[model samples]
Target: MSVTSAATGSGPSRWRAGLGRLAAGAALITAVASLPWLSGNDPALTVLRARSADQDPTPEQLTAVREQLGLDEGPFAHLAHWLGGLPRGDAGTSWVSGDAVLPQVTGAFAVSLTLMLGALAVTVAVAALACVRTLYLGSRRRLQRGRGAIGVAVLAALPKFLLASLLATVYGVWLGWLPSSGWQGPASMVLPSLALGVPSGAVIGGLLQQSLPAAFNEPWARTWHAYGFARGRVARHALRRALAGVLPQLLPTVVGLVGGAVAVEKIFNVPGLGRLALDAAIAQDLPPLQTATLSLILLGVAAGLLIQALRRALLGPALRDGALPALHAPAAARGRFTRWVVAVCALALLAVITAGLLRDPLHVDTAARLLPPSAAHPLGTDALGRDLLARLGHGASRTVALALVVTAVCALTGLLLGMTAQIGAGLTEVVSTMPAVLAGLLTTAVTGPSAWGAALAVCLVGWTPYAAQAAALLEQERASGHMLASLSFGAGPGYLLRHHLLPAVLPGVLRNALLRLPTTVLVLASLGFLGLGEQPPTAEWGRLLSENQPYVELAPWTVLGPACALVLLSVLALNGADAVAVRRRPASARTRPWSRGTGLRVKSGVSAG
Candidate 1:
């Protein structure tokens, strides 16, 4: 069936899906609006403390604050009031500032929107540049394999905050080419845009690079070539085809850009919605926080809908004809060289972890503060005189352990739900829109910020990607000839699942979990950096980076250890994922009936029958 037909279904089904999405969105909004009650903390006290940290208010003053802020009403009534006022441009009043929430949110959103737009442009440019050679080369698969692949992987692995720090240090402090902090003008937009865009763009570019080769190798492209179609025209058509497959990922990419902007804004000191939300969460200011959360949700939903529309448009005639190929895992470029790279990264990581474990991470020497690398302090000391080597070693376990737990949970949940087809796309899309940082804010309001809260926040939304992947893979598997043959032979669901589906889907899911490890580490570290995870004196990679960021210029060594460790971790996870893909390619190629040679044979046999 065509992509659109499969995706949209009949008119009634489309309506039902649309209604389902609306219901999910409403339910999400309702839950967010009820945060005041869901959080056990008294709204009055929270606001009072946020407003005046020094003064402790009495019962009468607390009661007055409650009455003024409408906390006297039940949570439902407050939600109703907020919902009622939303259409009229009233988002209620901020308890901390006593200002209107709508204006503050709007202003912040405008700034964020500007940054998102600039970042979006950069994302497109980078993706295009990455793909240009692949498109030009057309079907030259060998030539496309390794060119700049490592660089792209490295770029994809660099987290936004680290990149922002590097950009600020180089451009803002050292070179004096651009203003690094604050949103001043077009010039000020460059660093943050690059910082936010590069990683996401690399990811998008990598996917496109993989997809375009497959698209170009499709029978229709060969037919067009035979008919003397221009290479450029064929490439454009192939790009559109490839994009239809990749467009679903754009929703997460866009949402992630907005989410990553929280830390990016903090680093650059921009007054965007993400920063605003973070600040509100920190102060327990629910009014603006709620508004900001709702706005981000709306933005995500709108972006999803728009991207869906674009996908349908891109599908064009293929929607009716089913000319596009079924999507599958992209084969990794294979070689001994790739294996050697992976081994090297793994060894380096192990060395870092091992060396760190033997040292005293908490040992403080006032005289050794900001000491450069020496015999005693291999990685140098921080401003507080704590050994960087010990901290990094100790922090590796903390970071990697948390990441592993989160990844495993997300993978298992996603795989189960996906295999059973239990979670609807609408709900998954809505839930996936909530970034870990935003979720952290909500969790912090209820449980207070801690390592567990960060983990909880990550767990809440991290499963969506895996679930989406499982669902897609399940669908692809279901359409395979072996599956059809088994079904025709009256194989029960249980038998098919046990004998066929599990074996086919489990490896991909596990590989996905491995690939996602780096991101989980980054998210956990981001939370720590934001002070929402692992409070002071505990060695966590994110916290280390956060603590040492300010002294980046004065003591570059302080930040280098954690920063390099993060990059290496990312590279390791990526290479490991690639290795897994390469290892599985031979078996997958033989079993997959849709593969080039096998696909043609299958099609011919079906036509003959």
Candidate 2:
């Protein structure tokens, strides 16, 4: 049976599993809900860390803060106290500011929701337009060249900060078309929207580009053309069909806007929950963190569920279950595959080189510590008096560098282990069934908090998913005619793997690696926020959040800078992944000269049968 048949047959089981999933989700949320009590660290110590004092907190001061905060009880006592308050309206107060967590979260939540909704609107509009444009352009063979792949690469790999900076310079400074960065009125939304929407558009366009070729070549489309239907009408019908194939790709990308919005909000100085969540995580304040997580999870889940429903309603679940064109290599375009090999290598090198150029962010000064945002100190000074902007840059560099390393490691591991049959299956089940977070938690427990350990933890947890993918790819291609032909030619297993299989596997592996990179960065940021990532003075994004969280009330930039950096890097990684994953060998490499024909499909692969 084919993959689609298996998927269709398993629908009943999927529905059953969804109920079990909902129950499990409730359980997970409940468990996370209790985190305020379960975090074994001393709340007073967390508060003290934020004091920014020249001298140690006197015993009297410590005792006073502890008594005032009621932290004198044992862990169980605190847990019991917090659980008891759950029956009523109270959740607790912020650890650092001593304000009501609910109020703070609600206010921040308002900002985040506004930004989220705006970004979502922008995403949808841009994505739809992008798909249409790509479809129209794709049908024009004269223009479909290496330029498209390069353009997609640049857009996908462009960091949110870079894009934000470009917008600020072009529109805000020079053209006076829009404000550089702010969230005062409706006008402020324009540039940020473009900043976010453009890359998302590129991703949407790439998805459409991938599947559009096949959709256009579907027998129905060819028949319409054969029947002498006008070109425009036939193109319209093919595009409509292509929409069903590509809309599903937008679901995950939309879910990812959470990270992108965080960066955009911080860059534009928009007060949003992305900033709030980072601060909460940094401060190790359970209530606000809990509130933010609960809200985001619920929102994300809802949006995802809504998109899933939309896919079924508009596209139908049978799109996957039905015979359709896949978003794989266009068999006619093998020459352009070499170009992607070059792009992949260049992208990796560019990341590492960028990491090397960032300035050290840990050099501190006592006098400038905790300064608010000023012209001189653009992102202000953290509690350690290190420049927040500098730290953010360095932290982003570090995060990307480590994530790249980890992604490479994961890809290689998956490729190697996926070659085995029994071992691959066992590992797949283990990785699929078990959560990466659990592995991260255990690795951090063993290694403690450091840069390399964080990388190790990420690799340990992240590899399984990649391995599962790699194993599946291997299985799919192993039975292909090319492999069978090579085997029948008496090609040794090693030669077949090295020449035939590896070439087939490498591009897919590269795509998967790119896809996994953003996820790696997010995981590292989360771990860093938990004090399990790179230590301060070394300046990781999560570490900056952890350190400056207490100062958020005094200098918002301290929190926003790192938060924006985190989100920007994530978006960059995600966009790059999406851009490259759907990338195909450019058809122009195989097409006849543009002057020869109408730049349309001259020698089509599948015909109207």
Q: TM-score: which candidate is best?
A: 1
Q: Model 1, 1-609: lDDT tens per residue?
A: 323344445455456556656776777666666666677777788778888884678999899888887777776787788778988989888879988999999998888888888899989988888788778877433323553555566777677788899899998988999998888788988999999899888767766765676567655776788888887898998898778656766777787777557888888999998888877766667678778878877887788678767877887655544333343344544456766776787898899889999999999899989999999889999988999999999988888888889899988987776554423555556776776787887787678889889899898888876666665555445544455555555666676676556755676567567756767777887887887777889898878887888787788899888877876776676666555543432122343333332333232211100
TM-score on alpha carbons, each prediction:
0.87, 0.59
| Steric overlap count per candidate | 0, 1
In model 2, what lDDT does residue 247 have?
A: 50
Q: What is the lDDT of residue 134 in candidate 1?
A: 76
- The TM-score measured for candidate 1 stands at 0.87
Model 2 alpha-carbon drift over 4 Å, by segment: 1-41, 48-55, 60-90, 124-133, 137-145, 166-182, 229-252, 259-263, 317-328, 332-405, 408-450, 453-512, 515-609
Q: lDDT tens string, model 2, 100-190?
A: 8777777777766665566667766655654564456544422232445434444544344446655776788779888776677778877
After superposition, candidate 1 runs with Cα above 4 Å error: 1-5, 132-138, 209-238, 322-324, 329-337, 415-423, 468-512, 585-609
Over the full model, what C-alpha lDDT does candidate 2 score relative to the true structure? 0.55
Candidate lDDT (C-alpha), each = 0.73, 0.55
Please state the error at residue 602 of candidate 1 in Å.
Answer: 8.3
Query: Which one wins on lDDT?
Result: 1
RMSD of each: 4.5, 10.8
